[model samples]
Target: MQTRTNTFIAITSLFIALGCNQHKESVEPKNGGATEKTIEPTNKVVLSSDIVWQKLNPARGDQSPQAGTIWGNRNGKVATGFLAKFTDGFSSPPHIHNVTYRAVVLKGTIHNDDPKAEHMWMTPGSFWTQPQGEAHITSAKGDENIAYVEIDHGPYLVKPTDKAFDNGERPINIDASNVVWLNYEKSEWLAKDSKAEISFLWKSHTDDALQGVFVKLPKRFNGKLHSTGNIFHAVVVQGGLDYTLPQTNEIKALDIGSYFTSSDRALHSIANTSDKETILYIRTNGSLNIDNK
Candidate 1:
């Protein structure tokens, strides 16, 4: 708790010294000439359309009769993306992942009823993880197709079953050691040492491009001074934070679920001002190495 308190005060001082101009920056495209535009996205609303299957991209990762891919690892480590489209009322047989599996639902509904008896229904924004040797079954319901993001830990996609669909009448038994949940309630606060081993469900690692990672910060904790890609932004998905600019030694009080972007070439840190934990989803578009800085 003392470390948390120190973190909060440190972030506050950084914010105050930063005044108000440290959170805004202009982003330039990698090839130069073109300027990047920022659009404040609004909440998603469900609507009805009769277009049937929409092939967003030709090639992604792997496509099967019941499963189709969207995007996957393009150039090995530099870029990666993968997605699957499940047909209506399609249920895949129980299968196992020989390698780690990371996936997120883009649309429709998917149920993964392993490790627990309860049926877990995932919507469009849901993300899930399946470790190697973990066996599970999946399916899509209703008239629409189920789309998802998949990132494999190995070179190829591995499954225990050749059939993609299986009826939910009988249960399939397999090893339950590495099974994990992607959707979890944020903790009150997370310390560096107390940080849990979170599963990388689906991560698209792209150099010089923006990547989003979900992180939880415990209450009353201050953050360390760090720099990544020359520019960075932190959005409070939940709770509030008292932020600090490391270089300027200024601080400011930000409310719950607010948005803050760092200034150009400004060293920065953050703290949790609320009693509850702070949850943040961050995206950065430049080199993340800060050793020289």
Candidate 2:
């Protein structure tokens, strides 16, 4: 891949380093005298402040929306998750992306559609997707507009409408009001008795078995989110949560655009101490076991 822009900003080291080291679990002795360091996976949190912000398209470069990566490299040829912040009243000219992507609104409102489409402002908690090579425009009109954008594979690029071509995948624009919500009892990932709600967003067409979901917590909810999978990416989309820090056990308030992740099997401690419910966008290939604290 000769594309330099997509590989430009990568914090591969940071994602592995941002973790909080909780107590290591079940030490297994190594065989044949190999050094035994089989520690259990630890939880990591990337607060809004910890994000390294950069331009989404350095080529377009004209005040392009600022992107803060949560995991993977937006400019690389691998899966990526990043937060894109748009200026108020900002709108892009008709363009197409080199790869498909999914997004969740975290702050303010956004309008993404074909040039001739009606203006449909997607507010917080809304979900949308733009297929690769599709011609479209993105607009932000809120005082502060932010969204969590993700791609399965990237060097996510911005090309002129001339590059548009359908790959047999259609676009989906779902506003917050149109989204369906299910209580915990109806979800396999949440505790049945909890007030938490969950919504399905998407599932991978690849063998990675990746999927996207939105989980909502009731006010002041305290619980542990146990994840058992090879990959997990969680982002704060609405309200806030008190997350335990990796280095120190200090509780940090994670607002919109903040992120956290886990590997293999790990438990993440979270508390929705706010008076309102908090919603999180989770990209994972595992099962979520919500346990009350």
Candidate 3:
């Protein structure tokens, strides 16, 4: 009887040990290494006007080409932002972009014409969108050269839209001055003390992930430090600001045409140290959120 009892005890212990071993193996990381770090969806970047201006290249690879790009790499599957410069009298035949794009006229004047629609003239601060495969022509007006910032998902390609008229869809062209400016006093996403106005330029119909807006901050405006879990890009359209990056305690002085990007969940703040009102053109790839801190 004692020998039989010993065998039974040993068998039960072995089964328990085997079960624990199986559990351990199941709980172990599948990669067979330390858990991989989660990739944050945001990207932090800053591009000054001087730097981008110097990076401009002839769009057609000629000195007198109608269009030029400041910075863009459309060969990859990524989002691209480019500053396009069009010379006076610059024009393009009816063409369509492989990807939908948004543009903010930064300088001079731009005239967009569609064979199936009316002509629309866009000036500085004007914002517009061209849907993918929409046919249109663009030209620079007046003696000044036209420069606009274009943002889109890559790879950016131009194709002749000889049959776009058959689709019967109208393009979007809006002058920023005509858009109603809403006060940020009651905005839930901003600090209660923020004294600014905002004009929404574009919002994606597919999702709230993509949007554009123009913010007007009064002189000496200062806002509390806030963090957002969305990728943000801002350009100084008129005045200057001192932007702070909380993580590194670094401050950047952004002047006119200076651009910067904040990664998702980055802690940052912006202040208009200048005496003049500051206008900022901001774009985001996701919904904006404000941190309580």
Candidate 4:
């Protein structure tokens, strides 16, 4: 009878031990089987200090910019950028982002359109915006490789390029004869920097619409500050920026290929803290919801 009792107690204890181990595993973070665990910020992912933005190559004939974007997604943050290469034609099929896009052609000419605009030619230093839901078509022209910065609400590409548009659609055409010149030019301040050429892109009438400014703030420019949709995000495609928040007075220095967001309800701006010209692509919208602040 004593042996039976002992066996029952042992079984019960064994079950208890197993249960405790299972609970521990469920609560523990999967940190590559290491005992050390990293605690993420309350509402953010802090990229490593050494994490630099690097140019990504798209497939041939797709917008595979030779010198292009180094970017990040700031979880509902207000911004994103793509440094497109002119050497390789942008190859992705027509697609749309969760938000609208503002673009500035830094060098070479970019062809863009939908069934509506047909082939609209965008030249170097030209800035423009496209609304969400608008089908985008693209190709690069001219000998010089083109580079540009784009700004938009991120987590942008929601669908695969292959499924985004109907097949058999033709590329847009540019009427070299009727190219409407907005007569827009870079900011005088930016011109003096030599490395930077700053110019305002199109502005939106609605609160949630996409808006942006093109800047070639190479070593000449450090940073500029502005409020974007609801959240503030920054990108360092070429050099770097010391991003600061007006509300919190917090500063984050991000390098090339690095990005930072100032959080919702925070007033944020980017500054060129380094000697190298800090090329930038920036966009600001009121809120992603379009109706809400």
Which candidate tops lDDT? Answer: 2
Query: Between which residue pairs do clashes occur in model 3?
Result: none
> How well is each residue in 46-119 modelled by candidate 1, as lDDT tens digits?
11121123333234222332333223342243223334566566555666544444444445676654533355
Residues 21-129 of candidate 3 have per-residue lDDT tens digits of 3212111123321112223423343645454333233444543323333345554566666666666676777777777677777777886656444556677776666
Clashes of each: 28, 4, 0, 24
Q: What lDDT does the true structure give each of the candidates?
A: 0.40, 0.75, 0.56, 0.42
| lDDT by residue (tens digit), candidate 2, 1-293 | 01121221242232222111110221112221101221454668888989988876676675678998889998789999988999888889999999999998888999888877877788998888888988889999878899999998989888999878889887777777766666654554555587887776676778535677788888989987766566889999889999985446778789888888877566677999879989999887766666577
Tens digit per residue, CA lDDT, model 4, 1-293: 00111233333443333222322221111222111221221112233344333444444434444443434442346454555555544434565544555555555677666534445556544444455555666567777544444544565443434444333322222222222221112222221223434333334455424444334444433333323234444444456666554445577766544555444322234466567655544544432100001
Clash count (model 2, backbone only): 4
CA shift at 81, candidate 1, in angstroms?
1.7
Error of 4 at 22 (Å): 60
lDDT of 2 at 27: 16
TM-scores, all models, native as reference: 0.37, 0.83, 0.69, 0.40
What clash count does candidate 1 reach? 28
| Residue 83, model 4, lDDT | 54
User: Could you tell me how far off, in angstroms, the CA of residue 95 lies in candidate 4 after the best superposition?
Assistant: 4.1
Cα miss at 131, model 2 (Å)?
0.1
Worst 10 residues of 3 by lDDT: 19-28
Judge candidate 1 at residue 13 and give its lDDT.
Answer: 38
* TM-score-sorted candidate list, best first: 2, 3, 4, 1
The full ranking of all candidates by lDDT, starting with the best, is 2, 3, 4, 1
